[model samples]
Target chain A: MAAVKLLNCFVSPFGNRVRIALAKKGVEYEETAENMVTKGPLLLSSNPVHAKVPVLLVDGKAVCESLVILEFIDEAFAGTGAQLLPADAYARANARFWAAYVDAKMPECAGKIWKVPKGAPAVEEGKKEMVGVFKTLEGELGEKPYFGGEALGYADVALVTFTPWFLTYERLAGFSIAEECPKLTAWAARCVGENECVAKSLPDAEAVYQFVGGMRKHFGLE
Target chain B: MAAVKLLNCFVSPFGNRVRIALAKKGVEYEETAENMVTKGPLLLSSNPVHAKVPVLLVDGKAVCESLVILEFIDEAFAGTGAQLLPADAYARANARFWAAYVDAKMPECAGKIWKVPKGAPAVEEGKKEMVGVFKTLEGELGEKPYFGGEALGYADVALVTFTPWFLTYERLAGFSIAEECPKLTAWAARCVGENECVAKSLPDAEAVYQFVGGMRKHFGLE
Candidate 1:
């Protein structure tokens, strides 16, 4: 096997996506934690365009972008442990669609909770939008144990990384995700409890809350 | 082979992305052009979530999102005509990265030109941002004939859909893309000349210009 290394930031849900994927595949690799505040030379050179973390370095070559890197891992390590995406073409496309949906909707909706004043109209609007997004996702999840249906697959991996942030979001936004989307919340707990990869990789929710709280202060939001 | 159908809007570059990919694969399919002003039942039913164009229906199953549809076409029709994405994992990841970059940057930057006032400082700022994006893409292209290096591939298919709009953008923004990123501009011209799929699928630049002009007028910009 070619030597593998992952450049990641501890607090990033994007980085955790890679970590969980790697763990699921049972791939042994070195991980280097990066200081997002003061970016180092390796990160700058590896991801010159995005300058973002969760870059998977294979031997000497670098693969940037978490989703792209996830696809690469699945493709390159096809014969290894677990399959991240589905084998069926249509199913894989479905998984990709939902994963992309999570990416597109999460940041903007979640950012408002931490970035905006609590009493602001934008925060309330953001909460409404976030609920709508979660509701759509819940509909997609339907009766399936996982978004991939029976297995903790692509969409599961893509979304479970955000589970830790639920607490932070609930605390800041003043609404229970469990109250609004019980099935989705239950699915998240199932992932954390049942999946070894998810269990090992997810950080403490309280830690994430503290981290995000510090971030709000740093940005002069609190 | 399953019956394939594409629901699209004529003016959407996203729909055009799926169109070009299907054309490249030499797949015979039915296409229905939707009315953007009042979306029809099929469009609404097929993609209930986003309610957007570029829905690929295969054997009555709908695949929404243009990028996902492109990947589906590539995977489902593998070993048919031209390969949309590269076979090599690393190369495919690179193609995906740039295709995603185009998706992320194009809407905001290109959108400003048409959405904002003709002589607004924001339009100029948008132009500058667009040039920067093109320069980064140009650097990615380097001296290669295509983004896929030797052949028209995923990134090429993803981006060439926007070529018709370049003339409209240039005319609207009062800037020359050819002057700003000559290599990328030349590459676009090369794609139109060499690729039958692109040549046949791309609408005329003048027609796009007229369409956009009408759209601006509809919005009371002109």
Candidate 2:
């Protein structure tokens, strides 16, 4: 077996995605938490392009980009552990599509909630857009136990990482995600309850709230 | 075999990525050329989320996003036609990484060149940045016949689609891609020359120049 090492940052939803995937796959690997503010040589050398975290090192070969790393893990560990992607081609495409959606929409919406002043217009507009994004995701989820129907799969791994931030978002933005998108909120809870990997890997809600609060204060938004 | 249909716009480099992949795979497919200005029901219905072009409809299922659609074609036709992705997992990841680099960097850089006035400071900065992007890609290419070394693989399919636009970009931006990155230019020419799929799929350079010129005029930048 090739030795696996994950270089990550503790609070990043992106890094947490890799952790959730690795845990779900039952892969035992060493992890190095990096100081993202003052990035180390390993993080810089591993991902020179983006210089972001959740880089998976397999036999000293680095895979950057969380989504790309997820796909790589699925491919590299085919037939072992749980399958992150579906076997059918169309289903796989659908999963990839929604994962891409989560990647594109989440940061912008989440940033507005945390990075802007409490009463800023950007926050107001972003809250509305974030609700719409959740509604669309709810529709995609439909009545499935998971985005992968019965299994916690690619899209699940992509999204469930964000659930911990919902508390921080709601408190900061002064909106209730549970009220607006009940189905998605329930789905998120189900993901946490159903998978120990997800539960163990997600950061504590209060801690995340404090972290975001500190960030907001540091940026002079609070 | 399932009936394949491609919803595309003639001049979009994204749509061209799909065209190159389908052609490389030798997949017989119906093509629907859409007027992007007034999108049709087919494109809208197939891809409600993005409503963008290069939606590959296979047996009535739509796959949106060019890179995702490329992977779909490779997996769906695993043993037939040309292999779009490298067989080795690491190699495939590397190809995907650079293909993603092109996708990420191309639009912003290319937009700067053609969208702004020729002598604007933004254009000058953009030209320097574009040169850097190509230089990094040139480093990735090294001496490989293709980005995939000996084969026209995923990265090649993603990138060669842009070769036709080099002419339009050069003419509008008033810079020489050949001078900045000679090897990548040579590789682009080699891609068009060596592959029937690439040759047949790409639009004529002069036609692209005319289309871009028309777009610039319409946008009042001409």
Candidate 3:
């Protein structure tokens, strides 16, 4: 019943997070795709601090940062649907820790994959680090089927969006994420296959691959 | 009552956040200084992911990451003392955004002060960006006496610890933060002056200056 609107760029993993969170909560709202390069007024007004995508506007109130918005959705719509985070305090803290790790580690590794030219030696190093990043997550995943442990919870929501980027990174760096991190690869597949929210919210991996190629060209990296 | 132990380096702002948060909650805990460089076995085992400092051990369960620790402390000891975050969901989300800003923006800006040689032109650019960072916070602070409105809240706890580093940055960069952002200066002073926990938790500024100088020399950055 609350008016919920999201300002986002669809191809963004960060934007995918908000979509996944809202969908999990069964919150219906409007979403606008903001041009990230050209300054958009709505995004500027909503998130004056970062001016970044995935700004959730609830009845005109704005929540920025995908992780914060996930927490917001969980808290604001307390009774809505499945909670992204765990109910136990310690478990919630653990989930937050891994989610923070995903944010801290992912972008740098993901960027290196595309930032380097296809045949460059740097691409090899980038692939090594990218695989390392996934290996870390795979180690964390352990015997648990999901990062949330039997549920598609906070960290699952946090990380699954970026699986779409795996195609882009793998192709650019000439490495196979599925081969490097089989368990994590399987887990990602399970998230997309099992969770309608995750499946629907995430952009197609092929689309992400095309976008990354275009972006590298646009930024003169290509 | 849970058994709480903190593994941290004294000068780290991240460590200070945990100390302040614990003190705010009236929680009694053991403090062990961890060598961030050598990284003791306790820290390694406690935080295998990052192997970084400021890991909170509650009943021997390791909670890594300062911000996550802060949230854990708030939730784990619900009835102990003042809540770090606001009760309202919107306000809580806002607090998280600014805290994340402090984490994302501060280290990079603060690093430029010490990471560069004192006389380098990079210091001037760093100084400008450092001032810009403060101004953004000043703008966010607006007419409020505290970021939490009435008292030392989450964002306040998140940022106040970094004030000790300001002295070193200003000394190295030759720019006065007080002049650049008077309101934030006043607010920082108020936090240190008013909050006994903050006053005791933060390392002395002069000590930080010496540490930075020594570190620069050790790293061959001078």
Residues B42-156 of candidate 1 have per-residue lDDT tens digits of 9999999889998999999999999899999988999778788878999999999999999999989998887876777778888889999999999999989999998998998
Candidate 1 stretches with Cα past 4 Å from truth are: none
Q: Rank the candidates by DockQ, best first.
A: 1, 3, 2
**Cα lDDT tens digits for candidate 3, B97-195:** 999999998898887778877688878878888788888999989999899998999999989988999889888888788888889999999998899
Residue A79 Cα positional deviation in candidate 3, in Å, after optimal superposition:
0.4
TM-score, predicted candidate 3 vs. hidden true structure: 0.97
Q: Candidate 2 residues B1-222, lDDT tens each?
A: 789999997788889888888887778999999966688999999999988998999889899998999889889988778788877888888988888888888888888888886566777777788889889988888888889988888888888887788888787667899999999999998988899888888899888888888877877886
Considering the true interface contacts (CA pairs under 8 Å between chains A and B), give the fraction that model 3 also has: 0.94
Q: Candidate 1's C-alpha lDDT?
A: 0.89
Of the two candidates 2 and 3, the one with more favorable lDDT, higher being better, is 3
Q: Give the runs in model 2 whose Cα sits over 4 Å from its true position.
A: B116-121
Better of 2 and 3 by DockQ: 3
Flag regions of model 3 displaced more than 4 Å: A116-121
Clashing pairs in 2: none
| Model 1 docking category | high
